[model samples]
Structure formats: structure tokens, C-alpha cells
Target: MSETYYLHLNVSRFELSLNGSLGQSVNITNGSDPNAANIYPDISYSLLTVLLLIMIATVAGNGIVLIAFCASRRLKTPFNYYICNLALADFLVGIIAMPGFIVYNLFNEVWPAGTALCTIWMYFDWHMTFESAINLAAVSLDRYWSVRWPVSYKRHTSVKRTILILLATWLYMHIAFFPGYLYDRIVNVYGEHDCFWDLVMNRRFCTAVAVLGYYIPLSVMVFCNWSIGSMVVKRTNATAQDPDVAKKYAEGETRLTLAKDKARRQRQPLITLAMITVCAVICWAPWVIYFTIAPHYPTALPDILITVGYWMCYLNSTINPYLYIATSDDFRGAIRDLFCRRSGQTLSGAFSMIISAAPKRTSLETSVRRAS
Candidate 1:
């Protein structure tokens, strides 16, 4: 049901031009015409089913995280403030990016929504992706500062400061992705007006975007995690050597118990953040590298690799809420409380149980530490 358009190039001049449906035209040199080959092969029904499932999971999982944040007052701390923002970004990805991608793939890369929607999709795709990356980086920096300088971090990272940081993160991403929004153009590919960035024409700019958006944030995450790991190891060794600290805690010293409880609370969020960072790198690194290098040798890479890489990026947004449930007991409790409230259990009752159980869990953990 789709139309096909072709651009015949003069071999001597090697100029390629596309005439879009609305009479818009685009010119390029030394890049393969997207319509020149079968860039979008017919997808199998089974693969489509799998992709649909992934899309559903992405939407549902992030939605639960957002719901948990909204329903649980206990989750409203500054640390989780960043987490809520991350969930929001991921939720938007599920709401906007994934469905459009499913449609694009379903129709053999034909953008059914026309030029304006294409432009909007491209903008949201890049903007939300960049926003997620910044959020991850922000979470890493927050953890790094909180762990390395708890008192200072607590003093400075107030609710107002967290809001400012979130605002700054969005502003930075908007500025970073503005060029992509501006440069995106629609071209007729096999009779379908496709919206895409003209970055292939300027490989340098594409490389710059990838380096700034992916590599720098990735490097920051790695350093922060390494620093955090080193601090944990040093602190663990110190605690192991210091018998007085263990004795004080065992003897039910109020100050030491409070300190241990504070550390325990901070530890769970750090672990959750670390898991998210690892997942983000794994999911995003492939596409960033592929995109950055693919422009140089566009035909060298297969279409399936591009598709796989793109889906992998989307996969990151889907897994974060699961990571929270897997890593953080408090998050699990909050989610449970949210669901259990319908069964007549109040948040305070659930929290009280959690508070009452903490001492037993702590005692068991302390015993395990001594045994080790």
C-alpha cells in the first residue's frame, strides 16, 4: 500500500536528491540513498510479537515505578527524588518512543504519521534519551557526593537543590539535543516520507554528539562507581579491624545503632543506583558506538545490527523499576504497601512492621559479618 520513489544520480557529479510528498527537497552527497536498498526488510510476525511484549513491559514496569513514587510518601526523599525523575523519563520513553518505533518497524520503516509527527518523534526520542542519560549521571554524582561527604551532601542537597539539579539536567539536555531537533528533515524513502537527522552529511557533528552525550556520561559513571567501591572496601576493612566499633554496636549503644541504621538506609539507595548505572551502560553503549561509527561506513553495518542496537537502548528504560525491586528492600516494601493498601493495610502499619523488623535483620546481618 506504500508508494516508491527513486532518485537517479549522475555518476559524474554523484549528487542525490529526494523530493518529498509535500514538495520539500533534500540534497546529499556521498551517502547512500535510503531508498537505494531494502533498509527495512519484512519483519516476521513472531519478532513483532516479541517487540510488542517488550513495549508493554517497558510501559507497565516504568508505570509501576511512577505509581509507587506517587503513592508512597516514604519514597519522597531527595535521593529518590532523582529516582522519580528517572522513572518519569523512562515512562515518557515508553509512552512516546517505543510505540512509534513499533509502528515504524511494523510498517517496514514507513513513518505513517507524516512529516510533523516524524519531526516530533525524532525530537522526543533524542530529548528523552538525553534526559535519561543526564539523570543517570546525576544519580551517580549524587551517590558519589553523598557517600564521600555525607554531612556536606546532606546539608547542600536539600529539596530545593534537588529540584534545581533536575531543572539544570533538563536544560542541559535541551541545549545538547537542540541541533538534532533543528536539523531533522523528512525525505521520501520508498514512497514513505521518513523523518531523520541529516547527521550523515556531517559525520563530525554526529561524532561530537555521541562523544558528548554517551562517552562523557559513561566515563563519569564509571569513575563514580569505582570511587564508591573503593570507599566501601576501605570502610569495610576498617570496620573489620575495629573491635571497639563492633562491641559498641553489640552493646546496644544508641549513637552507634543510629549511625548503623543511617548507613544501612544510604547503602540500599547506593546499591540501586549502582545497578542502574551498570544497566544503562550495557544498554546504551552499543547504539552510541554503532551510531557514531556507522555514519563513516554506513553500508558496512547490517540493518539488523542497527535495529538490535536501537532496541537495546530502549531496553534500559524497561529494566530500572525491576532493578529497584531486586536491590532495595525499602522500595520493595513501598511497592508492596502501595498494592496492599487495597487489602486494608495502611502505610503506617506497613512501615511499622518494617521498622520493627529492622532490628532483627540488623542483628542477623551483624552475626553473619562476625562469622565471616
Candidate 2:
């Protein structure tokens, strides 16, 4: 039972809501006047159920990635450090964004959470997303530097520099959003005054941030990946030309083939990153296009597209751990340890048995070179 309001639109009048009812109506009338309504009968439970599963998987998966990283000392390294940040961003988004989105879906897209929650949701949603994008871009730069100039990379890419970069990324996002949070207010155009991230002041702010926070960083990541990938390809091709590079050495040989094997060992991580990039593009491209174009034209398709993009983006969190395990040997080992410890496997005992038995197998060349 909600009150209905008739809207007058220059020569056409439309009923926006039905009286004594909490929902809008689809029975639009246009006899010398037209009215718009929220067809209440159109609510779909199927979609709601799907959203629930997505939320659960997304949050749980990302949560595990974060927890595993935090608890595992063996996983600690400069490379894993940035990955840890990326996981944090995605995990935070899952916690902050997914729950609210599920609620909104359950409630028929009607936001009952007052202005504060709405603001917080918008902030968290945008912040964590931006953080993920920039962190990935930072990671690309790190990998590029590490491979492109290994010696110099070691000199500059210390733990301190990594931390500073991560901190700066967060700080920059916060500062950029400060103005919008201060002056913006969600306008409830749908009658129930559902709080949302409204286009305040001008859509220019949104456009600006979207480019700076997402597009620009994404571009940077692409560039870095391209450069590093090219270097890897060139090095690998050159190695193919080097008769010794591909020759199988005796297991007892005291020479390190670490450099020669670097690309092969790193293939999985590169594949994982490539997959992530594809997912990001698929998930966010539509939303980015919608946001960029929506200000000029408002339509149901744009809104629907944006919703689709949002869920797709949300899926990233859960997929990261699986991707890591599938891509990186180190990450898989960490997962193995985590599972082993939990499954009645001897706490320190199981790990000790595994560790004391045989060290990770390395070619004789690699072992000797690293020792030297």
C-alpha cells in the first residue's frame, strides 16, 4: 500500500506510483497524458538468488587470499607485497560492495540504508576499485623494472619504496574524492528517496576520477606489461639462439640456470595477469562507457549495463586466489600448507616432515649459481 504520484511532463501526465502501495506500477496510461511507473510485478527472485551466491563466493575467496597472505611468512617478499595490496583492495570491495549490492537486489533495488550508508558504500566502492587498479599498475611497473633492469631494480625497489607507493596510491584516491563527498548528496528520484551516489555539482567530477583512477592506470599497466613482455620475448628468443641456453646440463653440474629459466618459471604469473586484464576489460569497459555517456543520455539500457559491469568487477576478488594458485608455484605451495595445517595434518609436524625430507627441487645449475 503506497501512495501514487502523477507526474506531468510537458503535455503528457504519467502516474509514477500507485496509492497505498510501496511499489511503482507498470500500467502506464497515455490518453492526452503519459505516466511512468515502477512495474512492481516485475521483481525477479531468480536474480536475487544468483546475486547471493556471487556475494558469498566473492567475499569468501578474496578473504582467503588475504588471510593466506597475512598468515604465511614464506609468502612474504617484495613481489608478493604488491600482490598483497591488490588482494586487500579486492577483498575490501567484496566486504563493502557485495553485501550492500545483495541487499539492494533483495530489496528490489530500493535502498533502505539512509544517506550515511549510501555515502559510505559509494566511497568504499569507488575507493577500493581505484586502489585495485592503481596497485595493479604499480605491480606492472615493478615487474617491468625487475626484469628490464634487474640490477638497478634491486637497488631501488626495496620494501620501503613499495610501501611508500602503496600508501601514495591510497592517499591520492582519498584526496581526489574528498571534494565529491563533501558537496554531493544522493537525490532520490524514484520516490522512496532511495539514497545513491548521485551526480552532484557536475558529472565532470565522476568522469575525471574515472579516467584518472581507472583508465589512466589501466593504460599504464598495459604499457608496462607490453614492455616487460617484449623484453621477455626478446630475451627468450636470444636464449634460443644461444646454444648453451637450451642444452640440458648434468644434475651434478655446479652452474646456475636461474636467468635462463626465469621466463619459463614466470610464465604462469604472466598468464594470470593477462587473464586478469581481460576480465577487467570485460567487466569494466561497459560500465566505463556507460558512466561516460550516461550524463548526456539517460536510459534503462545504460543502467542495466552498469549493473552488469559492477557484478563482473566484483567477481575479480574471488577469482584472484584461484588464478594465483593456478599460475604461481609459490602461491600453490602456500595454499597446500594452509590446507594441510587445517586438515588434522600435524601442525608443525606435517610441515617439518615435508620440509626436512627434500628441499624444493632445483636443477644443479640453479643450485650452484644461487649458492655462488
Candidate 3:
């Protein structure tokens, strides 16, 4: 299937054209015509700028979260263990996928890095998505066990189990991408080559993947969220009858709030598993809709809407670190300790000044390297 697609680089607002069949590039352009009955670059540079900001925040925020979780001895718990995995997944995707996307968009959809890089982009995009989905499911189950079987949950939920789940998430996501890579080949179309899963002609196979990769996982996530949420509400209502905890609730106070404050005093993790699930839904709902619906309607509006949907998924990684900081008192204090020692510090200038002040770390220093 030969088709043309455009990628808009946020920094410079350059548009690149791609041959959807070969996953290669033909030429780049400044912008697409908005009113020519096709996809439009009607969105302003300011909006793109905001996206770039969001991307940067996601990378930096997740980076800090990873560092804090790794550095602090007190922050390690069963829930935090899963959160660390989530942060790692988000950080990897942000670093690998976002820059490549910026390059594609800035150059106007032309994938100058060749087919191999295209594979990498596709892999990172799908792999991280799978890991995130599984992580959400795992977190939901974790919460379910915690609330419904509190005693058993305390006995069974351990660092070892968390490790097993994290490993399983990685293994599952990598294996899932293998089939897409094996069967899907890049082809040249309309005088240019592009990379995709070759779903244009093989609608059956594409539909299967959509069902397996997206719809099924979405359904699972929805079920887990609903089950866990219902249990939490019921558990809270039941627990309200207790003497100590109930007395607090009867005094026009939220038990969850007091419980969190008490948990903070002990440096326990504060983010409820329910909150994490909600964030996942908010960040992924748009992209999932776009993915499922785009194949059916290949109109300009769908294309543009799907592009927006892709960015919305990225927003999850960007805002998750902040969520941890806001919800978890321990994380907030760790961050404060990380930078507060430096007097007259400004949040905006901290990263920039650090880069400028310190000697740059070579690629050798970082073991994790992305192909693109």
C-alpha cells in the first residue's frame, strides 16, 4: 500500500512527507495546505511549542522520579516498586520516541534515518505502550488484593512479586512487537518509500492486531479499574463503621486524607493505586480511540485527530512525575532535598545551568542507548 503522510516537527514546524509503503522519505515541506481538502497544519506554532514543553517535562520529570526512587532507601515499597517500573517505561519511551518524532515532524515526515530507525521508532512506541498497559493492570490487581484481601495482600505482596511482575511486563511487550516486525515490511508508494505494518492491504491482519494489541488490553484495563474502584468505595463505606477510623470520618474528615497524612509521616508511599489507574485512562483514552477508529476512516480530520491522540499518550509520562510529587509527601521531600541545598535556585534554570556547568557525559557513560 502506497500512501503519503506528514510529520510536523514541533521546534521548527517543518513538515516532512513519507511514503507510507516503504517507510522511507521523499521530500520535506514547510507546511501542508489547510483548505485543500486534506490534512492541514492549521494548528499554530504556539500549540506545537506547548507540546514540546510537555515532552520536555515528561522526560525531566520522569528522570527525576527515577533518580529519587533509586536514590532514597526509604522510598522502596511494593507499590513504589511498581511505580519505579512505570517511571522507567515512561522515561524510556519519552527519550527514545519523542526525539525521533521531533526529527520526523521537523523534517516534514521524511524519515531520513532509514528503515532501521523506523523499526526502532515503531518498536519503542508499541513496546512502551504494552508495558504501560500491563503495568496498569498489575497495579489494579495490586489494589484489589490490598482492599479486598488486606491480610493476604500484606502477606503476599512483596518485592519479589513486584520484580516478577516488572520482568513479565518487559518480556510480554517485547515479544508482542516481534510479530509486527516480522510480518510487516516497508514498501515504496507514490514515488516515496515509508514504513508501517502494511495494514493498508491486509485489513484482516491489521484488524487482528488492533483487537489483540489495543481493544483487548483496553477492555482489561477498564475492567480492572471498575473492579478496583467499586471495591475501594465499598471498602471505604464499610470501614467507616470502625471505632477509631470511623470516628475520624464522622467528624467531617476524609479518612483517605488522614490516612495519607499519617502514611507520609512514616515515609510510606502515598499514591493510591486508584489514582494511577485514573491517570492511565485520561492519558490513553484519546490515543486508543484514534488507533481503533483511524483505520476505519482515513479522512483528514481523523489523521489530524490521531496525531493529537498520539501526543496525549505522551502526556502521561510528562505528568506522572508531578503526580507522584503532589500525592506522595516522601517524594516531595526527596525532591526538596535534591535541590534545596543550592541556595537561590530557580526551577526553570536548574536543568539548563546544570547542563552548562557540568562536563557532558559521553555516550559511554550511559549503557542504555536507543537506535535512533
TM-score per candidate, in order? 0.77, 0.75, 0.69
Q: Which has the greatest TM-score?
A: 1
| lDDT by residue (tens digit), candidate 3, 1-372 | 665555444322233433344544555443574212222334458757976887788889899998888777777878888888888888987888877776666545555566777878877876786787777676667766675677998887788988998898777666655565555644323212244444454444556666656666667767766775676567667776667775555666576687777645532332355466677778778877665555666452445665577777777777777887777877787777766744336755887788899997788765555543
Ranking by TM-score: 1, 2, 3
The C-alpha stretches of model 3 lying farther than 4 A from their native spots are: 1-48, 186-193, 242-271, 296-301, 341-372
Residue range 1-372, candidate 2, lDDT tens digits: 565644333211224433444355354564543433332335567986777777677677767777788888877877778878888888778778888877776665666566678778877887788777777787777787787888998887777888898898888777666566555553334334254555533476787777777788889888887887798789878867887654544343444466436646766556767666666666677767776676656663546786777777787766775676677777778877887777855667787887899867669979899999
RMSD, candidate 3, Å = 14.5
Q: How accurate is candidate 1 locally (lDDT)?
A: 0.78
TM-score attained by model 3? 0.69
Per-residue lDDT of model 1, residues 1-372, tens digit only: 444454555322334544344343444433465433323446688988988888788888888888888888888888888988888888888888888888887766667677778877877777888888888888889889988998999788887888899999999887776765564442223234454565466465676677667777788889998899899889989988997877777766787879878878768887888889989988987788678768898887677876787788899988987897788777789888888876566767888889987845578799999999
Q: Weakest 10 consecutive residues, lDDT, candidate 2?
A: 6-15
How many angstroms is residue 97 displaced in model 1 relative to the true structure, after the best TM-score fit?
Answer: 0.5
Q: Where is the poorest 10-residue window by lDDT in model 3?
A: 33-42
- Order of candidate numbers by lDDT, starting with the best: 1, 2, 3
Model 2 C-alpha RMSD vs. true structure (Å) is 13.4
Name the regions of candidate 1 deviating beyond 4 angstroms.
Answer: 1-43, 186-192, 253-262, 343-372
